[model samples]
Target chain A: MALLEVKDLKVRVEEREILHGLTLTVNEGEIHAIMGPNGSGKSTLSHVIAGKPGYEVTDGQILFKGEDLLEMAPEERAAKGVFLAFQYPVEIPGVTTMNFLRTALNAQRKARGESELMVPDFLKKVREVSKSLNIPQDMLKRGVNVGFSGGEKKRNEVLQMALFEPSLCILDEMDSGLDIDALRIAADGVNALHSPKRAMVVITHYQRLLNYIVPDVVHVMSKGRVVKSGGKELALELEESGYTQFEDAA
Target chain B: MNVAVAKTGSGRAVSDLFASAEGRLPGSPSVIASRREAFETYERLGLPHRRIEEWKYTDLRALVGEVLPLAAAPDAAALKRAADAVKAHAIAGARKLVLVDGVFAADLSDVRALTAEAGFRTLRETLEKDAGLLTTASTDAVIALNAAMATDGVVLSIADGAQLSAPIQIIHIATAASASAFTRSQVVIGKGARATLVESFVAAGAKAYQVNDAVIVTVGDDADVAHIRLMDDAPDAVNVTSHFVTVGANVKLNFFNMTTGAAVSRLQGLITLAGEGSELSANGVNLLQKTEHGDTTLVVDHAVPNCVSREVFRAVIDDRAHSVFQGRIIVRPDAQKTDGKMMTRALLLSDEAEADNKPELEIFADDVSCGHGATSGALDDSLLFYLKARGLPEKQAQALLIQAFVGEAVEQIADDGLREHVIGIAERWLERRS
Candidate 1:
């Protein structure tokens, strides 16, 4: 069975429908990329999976590890090993990255009946993880995402995912506003943290990020639903040809 | 509305209280005599009433028109226990200034670091001294009242350019039935010095207690002073704390009032940017419930050129609770190049909860940038739905969103430990409310 399975999902935001009918399955260790234009519901798909508020699942079911995932809470979903890298990470001032990360990690750990990580041990592990992502240790002491550059904020999200070590990580427009160097750095950070026990859903408008962290499956999403599924080469074809064809097809 | 009309009543109440408190002081006759005159004047003026335009929204008259006589404290043992309990809740590692039942508890407070030569003294000592230190009338009615009636408070002074590593916690605990307690604190930061102060008022097992508190702070050239108030008491409690701060050239001053108590709790700041290049930041976080009302008001004056002032206040009102914020930024004609910004935001969690915000920018200088805005709204269903989609319970998601909303103001606070403590308080409040 797949690690995450969504069968005939129908989601709505407000009275208007955003996701009419969507179905997908992600097996462990596979990286799937969803490419689409603006208003394609790509971000909505990622947000819904991560349990963001506003978008409602009106029908169908989402099963994660054989359990009904749609019924769980956001933090519960997080504790169950799902992480969402927000398209626009909210800036939470007064909460240092270190403190927030520690709280989130301990919350997840405690939910699983695990012992609390010692402050020193946790700090050491965080520092190590940040170093691998090329994020400055000084930034970790600052407020979460406050005054962070676009790329820095994106990298911070990946850093959080790495520290949390979730089973399924959703990246929402992780490549937007990233320069060439930052794109490589962020993609490398995600690639380094990838493991056989983890599955990832990457949402993007462009195919640039795929160059660094190539995906095993690619899907074309438009008007709130995925219309086509293919391999990595499909991304290059769409990138070179533009979304004119897929926009009509989807 | 004209705040000047209410000035008279506020002055009278202030004078009466000052005289009543100072009359009992055992001190040099000379200092006492002058204070006595001021007290007489304060009593004649009395606390301001709502009929007065300036005091309209506050309605201080209603809060204290009855003038509950200041009752003597309860048993000494109980008062001492309350002080000890307060000492435990103080900002960790910060110096403690404990006031039990309206009187300074010397044993519970740390006085070893204080010195008369350094301008640090208890209100008692200041009264006995020949020093001609007196308070002048201002727009703040509460200040006059506090100055006239304050029975006990603190005098904190940092030497020129001395940086204090730890925050200072002034703990006021009132454990009395049918009693009124008054607290006053005076703080002076010398040139280039830096310090953070936390004023905590916690009431324990008190029935119908009234606390009138006041704090006066002065920051010298290049000095930085941060004042944080953490108030957690029963809903029957009544508290009115006023802060008067004067900033010298190049000094930086911040006042943060976080209140979570009382049937009617009002905190106000009367700040004066007296010298060029001075800066002031005033912020407040008020979380209220039931028919509770919490008011955070300020009157900021830019008396000198190149002065800067920033004010941000956020409130979360649930049930039938109410939160009021009235901020006034006045830039004088000669105070050119002054930059002042004020923003007050409120989150109404319940339909019955109400918020009143009046932010004014009075600019007399052509080169000044001063503006104020106030916004009030309930939790957006859209934001809530986003969190719910992630599998969070509706209540928990609302809590997170509420925390995030207020966190905007909290992030500006510089102290890490205190920030976390306030966040913890927010979390606890949300859990109880939820």
Candidate 2:
């Protein structure tokens, strides 16, 4: 069975249909990249899939592990191993990165009937993950992304994906605002999460990020539906030929 | 309605009580005639109330309906015990001062250098010099109402350039009921000195109601003082709170008040940036449940130039509880570069909960950044759903989000111990409800 199965799913934001009868199925152990131009509803697809507020699933349905996805809340979706690395991560003030991450992790563990980790043990893991991301331990104590630079915000999002180790990760504009060094670190974070049992949907506008975490399937999302699905070579062809060809085809 | 006032024969007794409360002046312990003159000033200024624009939200008319009695001599044994408990149980980093019925307990308190010079005396000494202090006690209507009412208070002073390494805490315990207690305290953080005063007013268990009055604190030039008041009086207690603060040239003061107890509580703070380049930041967090009614009305007057003022208030009200936050930030015409920001956000924890947030900014100067905002609403279901979807139980998710919301204010507390203490209280409250 596919890890995620979307059958003719329709979604709306503020009564405006953003996802019109879209269908896509992803099996475990595969990395899929959804590439599209601006206003192609890429970000909206990710947010709606994560159950963000104000986005209504009007028709059809989404099945995660054969269970209805639309009925769940955003946090519940997260606990179910559906992670959305927001293109623009919300800055929640007065909430320390350490506190938020710990709460999120323990929450998932408790749901799976797992034993809670001690503070010291959790702190140790946090320190290790932070160091791997080149994030200082001090930043963990500061409010989440309050004073972070643009690149830092993207890196922070990647760090969360790595820490949670979600089963299905969706990267939204992960390459935007990243410097060359930051870009490598971000790609490395995603690459580390790659496994046969896990799946990822990398959403981006440019072919720049695809070079690092090459997707098994490259899907072009335009005007709400996935217009075309092709192998990795299609990304190169599109990069060289530009998306105008798809716009014409649509 | 008019709950505080009692009928005296046929006339309204409130005006009469305050006029006497007003006539009573500077607690003159001194026999000298000059001391009498200062008392005259107290008479002239009179006791302020809701009729006064600044005191509108806090209706003390009913609060001062009955005349309060002068505080009885403190329960010496109980005062000492409370003092010992604080010293041993507090955040080991706290410097404590014990006051029974508003009178400083020398044997129980730890105020260094105050005994040697600067002619600083205890509240007891202040009373001796100012005989009128006791007469006007709760009777001045404010303190006269408090003296006529409060049991005791603590007098404190921080010398020039002397920075206390720990938070100085004043502990006031009331042992009487029915009769009110008027407690008066004066705290002076001298020039260039940095200190923090934490006043905890916890009443000794009692059945009758108690009224508390206190006016203490003067921050000097270039001085920095962080004043925190945690009012956790008895549930049956009826409190009328008032505190006056004056900050000198280039001084910075951060004042916070948290009221988690009392039947009906009203707190008022009058802050003045008395000199140039001074700053005052006042923040309050009120968590009221049941039918509890709490009000925090404040005035931050920027009388000098190059000074800044910021005030933010947050509240979590549940059940039929009511809360009011009336804040006024005034930038006088000559007060330039006055950056004042005020925000009040509240969460209606239940359908019956009520909250009134009044944010006012009166800026007379053109070169000033003054803005104010007020917001009140129920918990955001999406945020709650987000947390619950994260696998947390419905109650746990709600609790976590609530904690984070309140944590926004608690994180600003500089002292980690105090910050943790506040979070612990919030966490406990959430746990109980969950």
TM-score of chain B only, all predictions? 0.89, 0.82
lDDT (Cα, tens digit) per residue for candidate 1, span A1-250:
4999988888998888988888999999999999988988888777777776667788988888888987877778887988888888766555577866776787677767798889999989988888888889889888778889999999988888887888898898888888999989999999998899898899998888899889999999888788889999999999999887877886
Return the TM-score for each candidate structure.
0.79, 0.76
Which 10 consecutive residues of model 2 chain B have the lowest summed lDDT? B1-10
State the lDDT at A117 in candidate 1.
88
CAPRI category for model 1: incorrect
Model 2 TM-score on a 0 to 1 scale? 0.76
- DockQ of all candidate complexes: 0.19, 0.27
Judged by lDDT against the true structure, how good is candidate 1? 0.78
Fraction of the reference Cα-Cα interface contacts (below 8 Å) that each candidate reproduces:
0.25, 0.40
**Model 2 over residues A1-250: C-alpha lDDT tens digits?**
5989988878888778888888888889899989888877888788777876777888888889888888876667777888888777666566678887788788877766788778999888888877887888888888778798777777787777777778899888998888878898878878987999999999999888999999999999887788899998878887898888787766
| TM-score result, candidate 1 | 0.79
Model 2 achieves a DockQ score of: 0.27
For residue B138, what is the lDDT in candidate 2? 23
